[model samples]
Structures are given as C-alpha cells and as structure tokens.
Target: MTSQHAILTAEAHRDLTIRTERAAALGDAAMCCITVPDEFRAVQSEYPILFRLSDTRDRFTALAMFGFENGENLFLEDGRWDARYRPLAIEIQPFLIGGSPTDDGIGQVHIDLSSPRIDQGGQGERLFDTMGRPTPYLDRVAGLLGTLDQGYRAAPDFFAALQRHDLLEPFTLDVTLDDGSRNQLVGFHIIAEDRLATLDAGMLAELNAAGHLLPIYMAIASLEQFGELVGRRNRRIAHGRG
Candidate 1:
C-alpha cells in the first residue's frame, strides 16, 4: 500500500537517493505485473510472460512470471537476475507513476518512501544534483515511469480487444524438476491459438489496426520460454540453490 506520495519535484527531494542494486531481498517469488504493449518484446526473451485476470475478473494483465509460487523467484540468485533482460515492471521498483492527483497533477512520479530501495545514506543514485535538477538516474526513472503510465492507460483498451475477440483461455502447466518434484502452475491464462486461428479477416484487421496483433502474438511466442524456465528451475535444484 502507498504510505505517502508527494509529487517528485527536485525541491522537495533534492537529497533523495535511490538504490541501483538488484533486488536480492524480493526473493524467490517476486512476480511483477506487466503491460504487454510496452513490455512484450523486452520480456519475451527471458521470461515466460503470462496473463492473469484482475481481481474483478473483468480484464487480464500480462505478468512476468518470476517464480513458481510466492517467495520462490527462480531468476534471483547471488544478488543477480539470471536473465539478460529484466522486465521494466521489475526494473521500476518501489517507484510508480501516481494514479490520482494531489493538487499537482494526475500523472506524476511518486516514490514509496517505505520501499527498501530508498536510501538516504548515500549508497545509491542521487535523485537530484546541487542545482535541484533531476539527475540522470532520476531522469531515466522518469522515463520509465512515463512509459509505465502510458502502458497503464492503454491497458484497458488492449484487454477489451482480447475480450471482444475471445482469445484468452485458461491452461494448466505441469513441470517436473530433476529431483522428481512436480509443480503445477495454475490460474494463469493464455491466448487460445485455435480461437486466434479462427478469427475472421475483418476482426483480425480490426485487432491489427488497433495495435493489438503484435502483443497478442508476442504473448503466444512467450509460451516457449516456459520450457527454458524448467531448465532454470532444474539447475537451481541441482545446485542446491532452489
């Protein structure tokens, strides 16, 4: 939950510093939610990008599958992420674009002051320079937050497209590690290839024109990464790292 949020202006946070270190503490099960339109290509190569219904089950959001279960992130070890590309959703941690306004504006950067990444002891990237201007790191974070905000706003339309086309379906994943332990991944949904194949030309054209086609295919391609996830899990178990 957000404990406090203020507009991230240089004046009020000139001395603030953000930890650039990898999130070793997030542990084995840090599943970060992602928006497909922006993060699909960035996430597809290294993570099994999947989808999950929102609490209301009214729409689905893409998820960068980090661990098999809560507190079990297979990609984290020795303070490093095992994959080459960490999803931006994971990269932008403890900081997010504000969803509501506080007399400033609706879309401004807000930092979770309680986040473990916040450090005033000067161990991380400084948010602003002596001139009270945003530092390069802060500038980069602002870009990330801006991209996230755009994706956040675009999410409803994307999901609405999926719902209109009836492309999503629930599927179960069962994996066996080297040690003979079985893991069944549940509650996740995927694009129904059959349904996608059966779409009429007019409907496909509509999805394509609305910029939903590529992301839909990207989600389909991401299913291949699930095999590689099993390999990572097997190695972790073999090396006593799981």
Candidate 2:
C-alpha cells in the first residue's frame, strides 16, 4: 500500500469515535483537564502559558489546563515562544476526560472548533484550496482529536511507557479559521522543559525555509484570546459566589 494508505490503515485500527455531547459540554464549560508526569511539575509550574489546577496525592496526575484566551494570545504577546510567531484571530476549544485502568487508566484530550471569527472574506475558500476538498484538514483535526481519545484508551500503558522513556512523538493537526487561514497545531512539545527543542530539527528547518511558521504561530496566538474570555467568565462566577 502507499504511504498515505498505510497511515490511514494504521489510524483505522484505532476505531476512534467523537463524542459530540461531551465535546459540546466542554466548549460550554470552556475547560480541559490534562494529566502529566510528576517529574514535569516544576516545568509546568514555570510555564507561563499553562495553568496548573491540582495534583493527585500520588503525584501521577498533574492536572492543568490552558485557557483558550491565553492560547489565542500566546504568540503575539511574546514572539519569543517561536521566533517566527505572528498573531492571528482564530478560536480553539478543548475538552478532556480521565479514568483508571478499567477504563484504560488514561485520560483523553479532545479539541473542537468552537468558533473561527475572521474578518477576511475569503478565509474559508483559501483553506479549502490549501487542504483540498472532501475531508478537509479542519475536519481531519477534529477527527484526530477523537482518534487520540481512542488511542489513549486502547493503550494507556504504552503512553506511560513513552513518558517514562521520554520518547514522546510529535504530531500536527490542521484547522481552518474563520478568516480562511489554515492553522497547524503542533503537539507533544513538553512545555518549558523542551518547548520546540524536542521537535524534528529537519521539520523546523523546512518550516523556517518555507516561511510558514509565523502564520501558524499567529493562529495559535489567537487561542489566547479565547482563553481570556473563559478566564473572565470564571472570575465572574467566582465573584458572584463570593
């Protein structure tokens, strides 16, 4: 089979399913729960981009999340994160669920396109052209998020093994913004400890060569705007309770 076919076959083996109800709840709630290794706590704590919520007594569950608004502005506010980083106006929403061995003992992370309010008129058309028709990249990203959930569920032990060995793999997901811009979200960059250090140097070099990283950075920067809005809602709720 061709390389693309092989990849699709492998992905098919996972049997992923997107839980729309759960995803919608998360968007309405505007939150996510991420579990990381205990050893990464200090790194996470120091990372201004991520916010830590709580940790399990065993220290295995380092619960934290990234505010959509914070994610939106991450790049623009600080171009240093990625030198090629630029600022864009897009929207991203994430949701997560966790459980133990019976349920695979692994937590699932899901991301959705809550909104993509771009001012440009041709944004969608541009993205469609870049990705090609039928199963566009935006839909594929959403599908992958669900697939990620299945992967986590199917092999929690394997995930832990990767974590123990410090051998996480990097992957990319593409999203089409409201403005017709296409955004790529790079994954498995372990926050402050490595940032982009662990990424494939060749890929980074290629991106640099192609000069497309800045726009991606800007797209991610757009997430911070969403994060801020969630923060505001949270604060209002807290104040009301107080």
Q: What are the TM-scores, per candidate, against the unseen true structure?
A: 0.91, 0.24
C-alpha lDDT of residue 169 in model 2: 33
- Please list the C-alpha lDDT of all candidates, in the order they appear: 0.78, 0.32
TM-score leader: 1
Clashing pairs in 1: 28-72, 28-73, 29-71, 29-72, 29-73
The residue ranges of model 2 lying beyond 4 angstroms of the native Cα positions read 1-74, 77-134, 154-242
| Candidate 2 local lDDT, 1-242, one digit each (tens) | 11111212213222222222222222222223343232122323322122221234221222233323322322221212221211110121222233443564534433222332211323232122322332354355445444445533433442343344343333333544434544443422322224435657775565455543342243234334443434443444455520
- Off-target runs (Cα >4 Å) in candidate 1 are 1-3, 26-29, 100-106
Model 1 per-residue lDDT tens digits across residues 1-242: 34665667777778888776665553224655565566787788777777888889777888888767766677776777778987767777767887642234557788777676777747788988998888888888888877877777777788888888888999789887889999888998999999999999999999999888988888888889888888888888888886
lDDT of 2 at 175: 44
